[model samples]
Target: MEEEVENILQKGGELFHPGLSVDCVIFGFHDNQLKVLLLKMKHADKWALPGGFVYKEEEVEHAAVRVLQSRTGLGNIFLRQFHTFGSPSRSDRKLNRELLVSLDLEAHENHWFLQRFITVGYYALVNFSSAVPRPDATSEACAWWDLQDMPPLAMDHNHILQQALETLRKQLNDQPVGYNLLPEKFTMPELQRLYETILGKQLDRRNFQRKMLGYGILDRLEERKRGVAHKAPYLYSFNKEKYAAALQDGLQQGW
Candidate 1:
C-alpha cells in the first residue's frame, strides 16, 4: 500500500477517513425540466452526490463551495444550507464492516470504520445554462440526472437528494422565490412551471395568474421572445426587494 494510504490506516480507528464533510445536492431547472447532480464514487462501483471534507481552517460554507468547485467545476454558485444528517445508521457501519473484513486489517481498526460521523447537507440552485459538471479526485465522473428518473446511488445520497427537494418545496411554499427556478427574465408560463415543479401539483392557470399578479412582485418588461407563432407573451422579472420586504412582514406563500 502507498504511504499516504498507510497513514490513513495508521490513524484510522473506526472513523473511516473522518472529517467535517459537506454534501451538495445541486438542483437545476431548464426548459421546464428538473435535474440533480450526481457523481460516481471511485473504486466503489456506485454513484453518489459530490461531497468532500473541510480543511481544518475552512468555514463550513467555504468548504461546501470548494467541494462544488473541485467536483463540479462550478464556482460561486448560490447554495442554501438545509439540514444535517448524523444518524448512526446513516454513516452506516455495514459499509465499513465490509471494508474491514476485506482488507485483512486488525479488528481494533474495524470500529473506526463504523464510528459515528456528521454530514452537513446543502442544496445549490444552479442555472442549467451555466453549470459545467466535472468529476473530483475521488470520483470517476459526474453528470446531472432528471429527478423524474435517477440512477441508484450509494451512501444515503438518494435521501439527501430527497431532502433537497423537500427544502426547495418548503422555500417555494413559504418564501415563494420564483427566482429559485426561473431565469432573470421569464414569461408567465415559465414562472408557473417553477411553482408547479416545487409544489408538485398542477395549478389552475387563470386563478394562479390572478393571485400572482395580486402579489405585485413582478416588474413588467418591454421585451418578448420574437417570432413565436402564438401571441408572444410579455417578459417580466421578479421584484426581489418587494418580496423580501413582504417576507419581513410575515406574508408567506404556502405549498
Candidate 2:
C-alpha cells in the first residue's frame, strides 16, 4: 500500500497542480440530527474533511466528485460547489510536519507539499443509511459525526464546515436537495424534523405541513408509518416528475 501511494503521489505531482485541492463536506441526516463525514488522519489525532488535490487536466467540479467518491465510496450523488478557501494562514504546520516526518519524501515532493494551498469547497447530501464511508491514503478511519459533536478538524476545515452549512441553509429555501438526505419513504413529521434540524429552528407543525404539501412534489402513499407510540402518520415519497417540474418552477417562497 505504501509503495502504491508513493507511485500515485509521484505521478500526481507530475500531472496535478500543486497547492490547489478540493474538499468535500458530505452531509447526512439521521436520528433527527445532521451529520458530516470526517476522516481521522493516519497516525494522528486530527480529522479533516474528505479532500484531494486537483489534477492539472481535471475540472474543479470533477475533482470534487473524484475526492468524494474516493473517500466515501459514493458517486453520482447530489454535490454542489459553494466556496473556496485561500487564506494564507490556513496551512497546518504541525500536521504537515508530522506528515513530512512520516513519509520518505524526495526533495521535489517536500518542496511541493510545503507550500500554501487553496481549496475549492464542495458539499454533498447523501442518505446516511446508504453511504459507505472509506478512508483514503492519508486517513486511518472514517465515520459520521453529528454536527454538534464534531471533533477538532485539521487546517481551516472548521471554517470550511461553517461555510458549507451556510450554503446548505441557503439551498434549502431554493433547491429541493434535502430529499437526498432522507429515506425513500417518510412521514410529514419526519420531514419537518429534517427541515428543523437543518434550519436550526422549530417550525410550526401545521404551517410546515401546509407549505411542504403545497409544493406538489410529494406523493402521499396509502401506507402508514408503523411501530410508533404516537399515531402513525401516512407515508410519502417525492414525486420525481413533479419534483423536477417544481424545481423548474422554483419554490413558492420560503419554508
Candidate 3:
C-alpha cells in the first residue's frame, strides 16, 4: 500500500497524487442550535475533521462512513455525496509537518506525516437526539462545537466546514435539512433555529410556523412541552420515510 505510483498526477497515475483519503464533517443539532463534531489531536490541541484512509479492498464511501463512526461513535446516519477537493496546495492547506511533529505521533506509532495524502470530503447528518460521540485513537477528545462560534480549525477544515454548510443550504433551497439536529419531537422554535443556523438568517415566527406545518411532513406527537409562560407547545417529528420519498420529487418552499 505504501508503493508509490510515481508522477501519477502528471501521467494520470496514482503515485504523484499520493494516497487518497476521505474526511467527513458530520453535523448535529441539539438544544436549538447547530453543532459540528470535531477531534483534537493529542499533541496539537487544535481540532481537525474526522478522517481515515480507504483500505485497499474498501469503497471510498464506506471508508468515509467508517471514519465518521470511528471518531463520532455514530453510524447508519443519512450521509450525502457532497464534493471532492484536490488541490496540491491543499495538502499543506491546514496542518503541516511541523504541526504533526508537535502531536508526537511518532511516539504514538501513528506516523501519518510520512505519507502524502489527498482527502475527499463528505458531510453527514446525524441525529444529536440519540447519538453519543467519542474520541478515536488519533484524537485526544471528540466533542461537538457550535457552528456559530467555531474556533479556527486545523488545515483546510474551515474550508471543509464552509463547503458542508453550503451544501446544506443548497439542499434547503429545495428540501428541509437540520432534521438530524432535532429531537424525535421538537417545537417550532427548534425547527426555526435549525433553519436559521444553516441559512444564517432569521425568519418570521408566524410565517415559519405556517410554512412548516403546511408542508404536511410532520407528525404531531401526543405530548407537548409544559410549564413555560404562555401556551404549551405541541411536539412534532418529521415523517422521515415520507420526507425521504419526497426528495425523489421536489419540495416547493413557496419561493
Candidate 4:
C-alpha cells in the first residue's frame, strides 16, 4: 500500500490534472430514509465523500461520472453539477500529511497531491438496491450512511454535501427526481416518502398525489402491491416519454 501511494503520486502529474478534482454526493433512498455514499480511509478513521482527481484528458463532468461509476458500480446514474469550491485553504495539508505518515510514506514539498485543489461538486441519485459500493486505493470501505446520522467528513466535504442537498431540494421544484431513486414499480405513498425525506418535511398526501398526477409523468398501473395485510395501494411507474419530456423541459409545478 505504501508503494502504491508512492507510485500514484509519482505518476500524478502525467496522469491527472494538478489542481482540479471532482467530488460526488451520491444519494440513495431506502426504507423512506435518505442516504449518502461515503468512503472510509484505509489507514485512518476518517470518512469522506467519494472523490478523485480529473484525468488530464478528461472533461470535469466526465471525471465526476467516472469517479461515481468506479465507486458505485452503476453506469446509468442521474447526476447534476451543483457548485465549485475553490477556497485557498480548502485542502487540508495537515490531514494529507497525517494520511501519508499513516501509510509510512513521505511526500516532498512539491508533490502534486499536496497542492491546493478546486473541486467541482456533483450530486447523483441512484437506486439504493442497485449500487455495489467499492472503495478506491486510499479507502478501505465504501458504504451508505443515512443523511440524518452521517459521520464527520474530511476537509470541506460536510459543506459540500450540504450544498448538494440544497441544490437537490431546489431541483425538486423543476425536475423529475424519483425515477432513479425508486424501483420500477412503486406505490404513491412510497414516492411521497422519498420526496418528504429529501425535503426534510412531511407533505400533505392528497395534495402531493394531485400535483404528481397532474404532471403527467406517472402511469397508474392496474395492479396493486401484493402481500400486504391492509388494502393494497395501486402500483405506478414513470411514463418514460413524458418523464423524459418533463426532464428536458421543466415541470409545471413546484412542491
Give the number of the best model, judged by lDDT: 4
lDDT of 3 by residue, 219-253 (tens): 88898887777888888889887677656565765
Task: Please provide, for model 2 over 175-247, each residue's C-alpha lDDT reduced to its tens digit, 9 standing for 90 to 100.
Answer: 6755778889998988998999989899999998898887788999999999977888999999988777765
Q: Against the correct fold, how does model 2 do in TM-score?
A: 0.92
Candidate 4 per-residue lDDT over residues 198-249, each given as its tens digit: 9999999999999999999999999999998899999999999999899888
- After TM-score superposition, the amount by which residue 248's alpha carbon in candidate 3 deviates from its true location, in angstroms, is 4.2
Give model 1's TM-score versus the native structure.
0.80
Per-prediction TM-score = 0.80, 0.92, 0.80, 0.95
What are the lDDT scores of the predictions, listed in order?
Answer: 0.73, 0.84, 0.72, 0.90
Model 2 weakest lDDT span, ten residues long: 105-114
**Regions of candidate 1 where Cα sits further than 4 Å from its true position:** 1-19, 93-114, 243-255
| lDDT score at residue 198, model 3, on the 0-100 scale | 76
Q: How does model 3 fare in lDDT?
A: 0.72
Candidate 3 stretches with Cα past 4 Å from truth are: 1-18, 93-116, 252-255
Angstrom error of the Cα, residue 21, model 1: value is: 2.2
* Candidate 1 lDDT, 1-255, residue by residue in tens: 334443554454433336356889988887676888888765576888887666555688887888777655667666878999987667755665554545555546445446666889998877777678987654568888888889988888899889888987876644546655577888888888878876678999998788888777888898886678888998888888986676455344543
In candidate 2, the residue pairs with backbone N, CA or C atoms under 3 Å apart (3 or more residues apart, or in different chains) clash, namely none
**Which candidate leads the pack in TM-score?**
4
